[model samples]
Target chain A: MPERIMPGGVMSGVIEAVISLLLVAGGIFVFIGSLGMAHLRDFYMRLHGPTKATTLGIGCMLIASMMYFWSVDGKPDIQELLITLFLFITAPVSAHLLAKSGLHLRLKHADKTQGKPVELRPEEVGDKPVPHPDKGHG
Target chain B: MLSIALYITLALVVMALLMNLYRLTIGPSLPDRVLALDTMYVNSIALIVLLGLWLNSKTYFESALLIAMLGFISTVAVCKYILRGDIIE
Candidate 1:
């Protein structure tokens, strides 16, 4: 009877361990971030929670993926990098737009929360009237 | 050892997903829900990457990328709707 051993089995084991550690850490960050989102009283504060967590958490996980693939296949697997880049660029923009809209809608928060007052846009307040200084001449 | 670590990672990700779900359900306003959903999208991307590692396949990375792109667009559209009451002019 002969014992069989899979090729690259040991190396795969090491790679998997590393990737798993990376993922667990990333997940912890994400979980904490979500908790912040759920527990925060104000919309603006909640906005910061997810933005920081999602970006860093996703970035870490993507790097883990890149590491795992590069180790096993010995090439720079760049797909994960592209995903990270996309997330980084868009997360802040989306958060900003949402915050701006929240302000526009006058979303209120609990007392003791000191957010800057929403700047009333001229059009929103109906304060911008057409110029009528010369209307009598017409 | 590797299996144990993978299982732990999976558990943590699942916990994160559950937390995000809670936020989505308890959100008091529309933007709150939108923010929670956006967080879920980001978490989902991370989950996909971890799945790729566990399954030992690079194909899942593509799905993660797709989610990132689609999630961003959807969030933007939702924000626009909330701001102006319409997505298209």
Candidate 2:
């Protein structure tokens, strides 16, 4: 019956079910991740939403795509595989850069974030000037 | 049966896209909006993949790739603009 679902290659009934299930799961994960983005209070917390949840979500979708094309199209399409690789490689780099930019701009951080950002004035940046009133002549 | 399942999945993904839109529009900070846009693009890829399956087409694959590249580049560009007023510099 499941094999009848496709007009293409050699997918069995069980494999079809698995692929569909995976697709649904991936969709749900993507939704949850986006939901976190909308719902979380702070920007850094919001970063977690897309970076962690959506990354996994997209990864799942790519795997399902790979499996579906491999069996139904009768060719092991590596395009999805490449996307998967590209996403996994880039997601972290983007997240790190985004977070770095956020920190660099001195974006407001949640109270719970450890290691509070140092308040560096533009003039006092170089030579590691100590913040002692005794040496505080500007 | 499979069609029915795919339809349900499509609805869920659409709902997610709506959420991303909400964040993109009403997010308090620039970073929040940028994050929303990033997540939205990723969600769009998922939607395109689902649409491809529904229509039994492969051409959407190229579109998805384009979205992936553009989304990343735009995000980094915007973040750079935020960190420094000039993107090129």
The recovered share of true contacts, given per candidate in order, is 0.75, 0.57
Query: Which segments of candidate 1 are over 4 A away from where they belong?
Result: A1-9, A12-20, A118-138
Whole-model lDDT, candidate 2?
A: 0.77
User: Which DockQ values do the candidates obtain, in the order shown?
Assistant: 0.59, 0.53
A77-127 in candidate 2: lDDT tens per residue? Answer: 877877788778878877876876666656677888654447544422222
DockQ of 2: 0.53
Best candidate, lDDT:
2
lDDT of 1 by residue, A1-138 (tens): 112123455456666667767777777778778888888888988998889976887787788778767776778877888988888899889988888777766788767665545445554422343234666332
**Candidate 2 CAPRI category:** medium
RMSD of each: 5.9, 6.3
The Cα local distance difference test for each model comes to 0.77, 0.77
The residue pairs in collision within model 2 are none
